[model samples]
Target: MSAVVLSVALSASASADMFKPSKAEQMKLGKQAAAEVRKKEKVLPDSDPRVQLVKRVGRRILSTFSEKEQPWEYSFDVIESKEVNAFALPGGPVFFYTGLLEKFKYEDELAAVMAHEITHVRREHWAYSQRDANKANVLLLGLSLFGGRRDVLSATDLLATFYSLKYSRQHENQADSMGFDMLVAANYNPDGMVLLFETLKQSSKGGKPPEFLSSHPDDGNRIRNAKTKIEKSPKEFPALTKINL
Candidate 1:
């Protein structure tokens, strides 16, 4: 029985290896999907002063953290919505909601949030996730073709869903860490990261939590992590010098 189990495990591992997609293929597919999503999404104008400010700050922070010699163009825009959310897609597409900007008490806090989202792109976290999803689908297809088992295909689909969700959470944590480092390197106040989380926690108290809050992990956990990092390496806050707002 032990030998049989070992043989089954080896087979599964080999199948998994065969399913993995190349990074180039994943990038092509991800860019195509992103283009479709962008068409449906409304992006704020670059001419807007607030939008420009975000870009300026984002560039500064990103320049410090990103070592990749490639030309990474960063675009920051304020979506015309009240949702307290910000997201960065693969290839440096970033959107920040007006509500999130209103919640920031300090510029550093805003920068911290921007840095966190930007890290998602810089680290290619989304690309990796997309690659993994494609790989899973490939594996499912192979199983259906070779094993001729409908059950295997169903199981693979379910596993892919779970894996996607799990990968999202992992990506969030990684961005958080990268953001912390980026903010510190740029000489921005790291406490701003904690403050942003505190704002989110407070916002969730009375009314229904926003979609962003629901999608992200607990604000308390994020705040705690930010605070711990801040205490270790505190940086002076920059003066409010002609903010675009």
Candidate 2:
């Protein structure tokens, strides 16, 4: 092969390798990201009673799921902002905005949300995205140095972010399923998921919805999906009254 072709082949191989970061490496990067996020955003200490309560409930739900054994640590915070967003970082760090908690009429509903976020960590979706981002970064660096255009590097970064967001949506769906299962296993109301989604949908109709709802695809179809799943698995649906606050 010509030198140019050989170089291209080498670049492709390196790019391919970039796509596969070891789980350890991905977790390391995710922890780094979480630290940065904490610095910029208000994160509650796990020591607080309220935070501990969240951890207790979260742990109970997480126990039902099978995932890699990681040092899972859960934290709760009441963000002063009205945004209803909640997320979990790869290694086990989780956050729930106060806006979401306040909207729930019962503790079981809150458990549903917590279970969903925990599912994200348990399923390793965040780690997968981190691996993808690492690969994209590597590819972009290679293209910047090689015969590829600089504009391609910029485009790659943009595309990587978009891909990350798409993965996030998929993660949300997987979490939804896993979370429902977890709630059922823990004997929390499975309908809480549907109710939470309906609340989100209703909240979106009046004025501007919280950032969480805005960033996420509206709960319209998701609400329906949750309900359908509940209907199909009646045995898994626990009595809402059994959940202790």
Candidate 3:
């Protein structure tokens, strides 16, 4: 694949109760975290085929954004782990585990995963989550000091837990929606997203579920949602194709 400059503009959206960090701050923190991960985790070398494929798809998906919109210096790395998981840090450090990569049989499938992770960073979900968690902690502490009752504290904990789960589910769905658009915008087949979900569902049949699925939307719901989007916007997507590295 020809090299493309993949970048995204920093989001300036406002939040009612969240303390959003500056893009520079996020990048710095992400770099620190990524460095620590590299030090402790067994990262695959660039020469590894898996790493190369990840970078290739990642760059393609990122190319959908303009170069002038550069806000995060995104980097992709592969981890030598058996757990089927992938994640992106605050600014732009994305990691893929070998187990997750092994499940991907096509480049488009890989692109779907990469695009979803990229959306998380682009939307600043982690920063928002952290701020929300901080608020919950403060609220809980205030309740503890004022209420001084076990039942009151339990109720607050239950509410906080509910809100966290709801917010997380919302984020996961948003990532899926945005990532599907990015996949198509990058010229990969949009069906790749739905197929990727199907693969995950199949993988979870008779054994422990993938770590990737732990925080994500239910597989059935995700697949149905993707299909609904494609059905709603048939003209927006190109003909389906199987893209292999």
Candidate 4:
């Protein structure tokens, strides 16, 4: 099957993934998962304060994006759960648990979460994961936009289950790096992101770790990476000298 290289707006040196799901397929899986989650999880309404906060922070991160060329549709939802977890469906559905929401003390911290999750969807990480796992139930169904009914259950499980949703370390790094750019582009303090990593590190319980942090063991490395980017302060922002963060 012929496939086009879907280049992501990350570091230019980062190699793009190929032969992944189409935009339509990813959207379909996302819609399917969205329906399933609404039925099974206690998703908060837009009227809820927490949900409102998430949307506000999510918009901040999203506003910095320049990829109107892509067909992905972004949606943010907050679920009433204590688990410190948040994951993104292939198309653009990003869910945040109440636990994660309550943990953030600043808008920047929340923006980091939104930025990271959005990056996963923007970069089509799930489609690449399906390719690695050979899970045709999720991959061949195509990480589409909507209208696909095939493997609906599998796609739903892929979004809700830890095993299916865990991104590889490399993908995690890319999301962090690219997400940093998004946060900075929005003119928010990038240090909040590093603070989030520290929050995760300090909050991990029982050595088991939350599903979100369990997949990647290198939290320290990610923190270091964020600091490095801030220190380097590329030409994108020349006022770096005045910004304390």
* Model 1 misplacement above 4 A: 1-38, 66-72, 139-167, 205-216, 234-244
Which tens-of-lDDT digit does each residue in 1-245 have in candidate 1?
35544454447556653333334433443354445445655656788766887888887886775365344456666776676777664566577877777777677878888888777766767556645654455444442323633223232343234223433667778778888888888878777777777787788777655433555747477788877886776466565333347
Candidate 3 lDDT, 1-245, residue by residue in tens: 11111110111113343334557767777787778778878999999878898898888888779777569889999999887778887789999989888887667788888998898889988767755654455444432212423223222333244223333887888888999889878988778888788888787777666534667636488888888888887565556554454
Runs with alpha carbons beyond 4 Å of true place in candidate 2: 1-18, 44-49, 66-68, 71-78, 134-168, 206-216, 234-236, 241-245
**TM-scores, each model vs. reference:** 0.70, 0.71, 0.77, 0.77
lDDT of each: 0.63, 0.63, 0.71, 0.72
Q: Give the true-structure RMSD of model 3.
A: 12.0
TM-score ranking of the models: 4, 3, 2, 1
What local lDDT does model 1 show for residue 108?
A: 80
lDDT of model 3 at position 96: 91
Better of 2 and 4 by TM-score: 4
Give the C-alpha miss distance for residue 142 in model 2, angstroms.
Answer: 2.9
Clashes of each: 0, 0, 0, 12
Those runs of model 4 whose alpha carbons end farther than 4 Å from true positions after fitting are 1-19, 135-154, 160-164, 234-245
